[model samples]
Target chain A: MSDQQQSGGAAVASSPPVGETLMEVTGVSKVFGGLVAVNDVNFIVPRKAIVSLIGPNGAGKTTFFNCLTGLYRPTTGRVNFDGTDITAKRPDIVTQAGIARTFQNIKLFRTMTATENVEVGMHPRLRSRVTGMILRTPFVRREEKAARERAREILSSVGLKRMDELAMNLPYGDQRRLEIARALASEPKLLLLDEPTAGMNPQESEELRTLMERLRTEQDISILLIEHDMKVVMNVSDHITVLDHGEKIAEGSPQEVRQNPRVIEAYLGSQA
Target chain B: MRFLASLRSGRDTVTGMIPGWVLAVVLIVFAVIFPYLVGSGSFLDASTQTLAYVIMALGLNIVVGFAGLLDLGYVAFYAIGAFVIGWFGSQQFPDVNGGKGIHILASDRATFQPKLSGGRLDIAGIHINFFIVLFIAMAITALWGVLLGAPTLRLRGDYLAIVTLAFGEIVPRVFENSTSGLFGIGSTDFSHGRQGITPIDKINLPWSHDLLYSDANLKPAYWVALGMVFFTIFVNRRLRDSRLGRAWIAVREDEVAAASMGINLVRTKLWAYAIGAAFGGFAGVFLGTYNNTVNVDQFEFGFSVFILAMVIVGGMGNIWGVIVGAVALSMMNRYGLPQLNSLSEPLGFDVTSISFGIFGFFLLIMMVLRPEGLIPSGRRRLELREAEIEGSEDTGAVGDMSQMYEVRQ
Candidate 1:
């Protein structure tokens, strides 16, 4: 989106100087039948920042996320990630290219254990083809051992010490964290958490916010969170973008977005 | 009863005091000498055939159970493999060797010898050894697997099953119809019409006489087939733990999510098909050698269904389940039908003629009584249990069934 205080017919606020853009979305629009779900939205996520996307329900926040992640090809514009024009790339290719994501609904492999889910995320990093697997070659064995060790490390770090418990059997809060841990296993340059703390307790949400901050600093991974909880969003995000009716309405630092009238007007209208 | 219990709990008996591997070693020793213990060549022959079926069923399980792809035409691979042996091992094409039979791999192979005539029988062209033909069968079948897997990449569930079924039907028909070359391309006869390529060069070692002609010494075939079963089990176990195996399960669980995890759907599915087909070829080559023929009649839609039934009746993803299913179904097909004949003989009906119908009944019972099969994987078992709970109409029937587990209180 534009860095200007008021540009693209939407209210905006300037943030501090940001790094090289990791993701630059330029004039992206996604249309479904007759509805413009994501209507010409320009968005940017700078390197190593926790960005929150806040909008009312049906504001096409998820649709925009899908576009960036390559689930839905942007019908009209380009998405560039790490200098690669990744517009309309396949979802798996997007993952392989190091943009990992967790679904809003917690898409952990239900029957598989938490560790197994995380191991799946590690698939892109690990390379053991069928021949090596069948032969149990030394390199394959070493890779497997290292992968399992990495899984144990990731699981414990995410506070999921019981790696054997099935993802579905894990508690709701743990399951959400497990999903994050699974995404983290991919070693992505950017992670998109789609309302991860939804249906979580206040303490759980606070814990997730802390985890998000830690992930950004420790792993050098950028975070793009979609959240309704203003407390977590305002406290955790370096930048916040507000959307209304499939269009960008406000963009700024937390303080600047908090003072932006357009954002408040959109939320109030939706709530009313 | 005490004796049976003592035998059952080997760990409790004097033998039970031994370590697990010791017990396994003892079992291996027993298996090695099993043919001599039985002393019946016909029984050993039947057992060897069962082993071949077991291998085929295990292969089909990789696709259907592990990958969650319904394959109705797995027998096409079997046909391809058998044909590989038929083309490579037998004297089907006399033009290849200038009308002289050539022995390959087996230095002692009686060239074109259909019977123990104590002399090399002059027959058609190429009479390659069985060992070389076996690998060729596997390679060709694996290639067919990729071809079959490619078209079904976009297909799912019933559509996938239908496409596979069409393939299964087509392969056999092509073999049956092609009395000449493939679509009449050449003058070479591939299968020799309905007569089939006869007396498929017996499995002769460079060191020993051909097993088929070695005075009913079926031991070699038994040991070899058992070795194959063990090989299959080892490969299947390795695959189940590997990255590809995980991808198979992931794709089975949620294709979109798997794709998002960077597991290429086509690659994962193709591996399943290729691996499964390779084994089918392995068994096909074995069966062709053992049966002494690879007729188009043997490679039918019914055989595909039979193997699929074994996978389903055995628990789908569970390796042991499929083995048990394959062995159980195959043995039943071989031995059980004949036993039914004595019972049906009094009623003046030929049970032998209706043996297939009996198999259909067994399948029907299996589906209704245990949809999850004999030894279901942990995930499938739980999913089935949940579905049962939600559907509660079966609760009453399940309760009645559960009472069977209650002791003689």
Candidate 2:
């Protein structure tokens, strides 16, 4: 429990943010016809912090993330990202404004090699357009070279040894790592990982925890996560926000969130 | 050389076991001497036509193969490109010159002249050089591409195909009907209606003094067509590895993921149409000049379907596969079924008339035997295999794979 308090001491959402706020969500909700998947969730992600959004199944955790990332426009709400009014800006715009996400199902381009997938991640950063590609100008060549080197460096950083292997051919854990590598290749200041440890073993989850910490400290990147595992949620997050039926029930340090009565009731009621 | 090597490196990424460099050199040598080996007029003409189709297939490959846009009416750009030549390179519209011909880049020392007497109008026809018209055609077709792609931005799958097919059909008919401008929107006669334009100028280099598209010796035309084919292949190869191409493939694979990675789908899809349409227009100029006509009848839905078949049969994303597919199908259309006259003697049916059915048969066979295509790209082959695997796995249950793959209503 002290581990949770020590980790959360760096940044807490309830208190005025220690770092500049990177994203601000106000009353964000999503309704699917008859179903309200998410409802009136307000939260903030501070700069260079790992924030966890934890909720039980169908609690609208993913839906909340989707709203923030513009996969689905919030039924009614506003999201400001890095000083830009990014509400309902398409996913590409969201990414260009420094937010990149990975799918929960791991949607890697199955046919392209791992490196190629990473190269695709670097698309927004690439300067050469169609004409330069056809002309094969010196600048295009140099850009391509820089992109390849960066893509390769990202792959090795993610512990994916083989850049040439097709994405689908990689082991399950490696495929997950490759997806992160691809997201990192975008040079995103804010990374929204759907579930970095979802389907990962204990050892793999440990590696992911260390990796997330390194990403926060070394790369100076903020991470927003939808994590189910308490181990990851408690150990890695500087701030924890629990969502139930798309409503934010608790927002504070991990230790404070753990002792919240509403958080317990929401999980137990949903399970029952 | 590194850039060039990367252009031809698609296959190497998949299976680089073979030394393709030697194979490429041999193929180039064979292509350089192809006209001389069979100096016969008919053969040269057939191959030149095939090369023209090759340019079109490469262009369409960018749309359907790389971008995964199922465009059924790609020939619209070709018609527009051909008209660029028809309007500018020939004397189709005579009022523009005020009875004086427009001749730039024409040979000065030679006495050769265009046939200006046979126009449908009494006004003297203008004749600009072929080189300038080529660029104009590309620009026009590229503009039309953006225009056509505008409505299809929000559409996908068969719906996108229907809209594009409609656009394709509309262009030629407008060209056919707009003898005195579009629906009375303008005063000039853009096309000659059903009668069509004629006497398109031959392919003329800036330095050439003679009409090179004559039937007596088509060697120059062959070289010109071959040069365009090389240009098409080179551009196609370079594009296949570019960031734009990667974005196309990304959009094709998963649009949401690609967008999340910061690829603007609208811009990517439009670029595919514009660049692809430009290539179609490039070949259109050559085809219009080589055929010596730009008739409305030549622009048909069937020609679009024929080009689509070449792309499908060759291999969707593979540039080499598309080229081989175009050449093979074009040759077969010209010579294959005709050579099967012996089948007519035995079956008591005209084999030549059933050429389309034979083509259908070949397509059916290719689909049944090798659905991935003749030279399947690594990506397409994997897609086909995954589909196959999913098909078998689904058959074991009640829900079919087709249901999942079907476009959302």
Report lDDT (CA) for all predictions. Answer: 0.81, 0.83
Residue-by-residue lDDT tens digits, candidate 1, B1-409: 4753454366347545778778768867976788888875778888888889989999999998889999989889888888888887877887776676566654335454546445554565676777778778888899899998898887776788899999999998889877878877986788887777777777776566544344357788898888888898889989999888888888887666676677677788998999899999999998887788889899878889899889988889998789889988888888888898898888999887876677688789877777788767888776677566767755654464343112110
DockQ of all predictions against the true structure, Cα-based? 0.34, 0.46
RMSD of 2: 6.3
Those runs of model 2 whose alpha carbons end farther than 4 Å from true positions after fitting are A1-18, A270-272, B1-18, B107-123, B345-354, B392-409
Best by TM-score: 2
Compose the digit string of candidate 1's lDDT tens values, residues A244-272. 77887878889888988778888886344
With a 3 Å backbone cut-off (N, CA, C), the pairs that clash in candidate 2 are: none
Q: What lDDT, from 0 to 1, does candidate 1 have?
A: 0.81
Q: Where is model 1 more than 4 Å wrong at Cα?
A: A1-17, A270-272, B1-27, B107-110, B113-123, B207-215, B345-357, B389-409
Per-residue lDDT, model 1, residue B84, is: 86
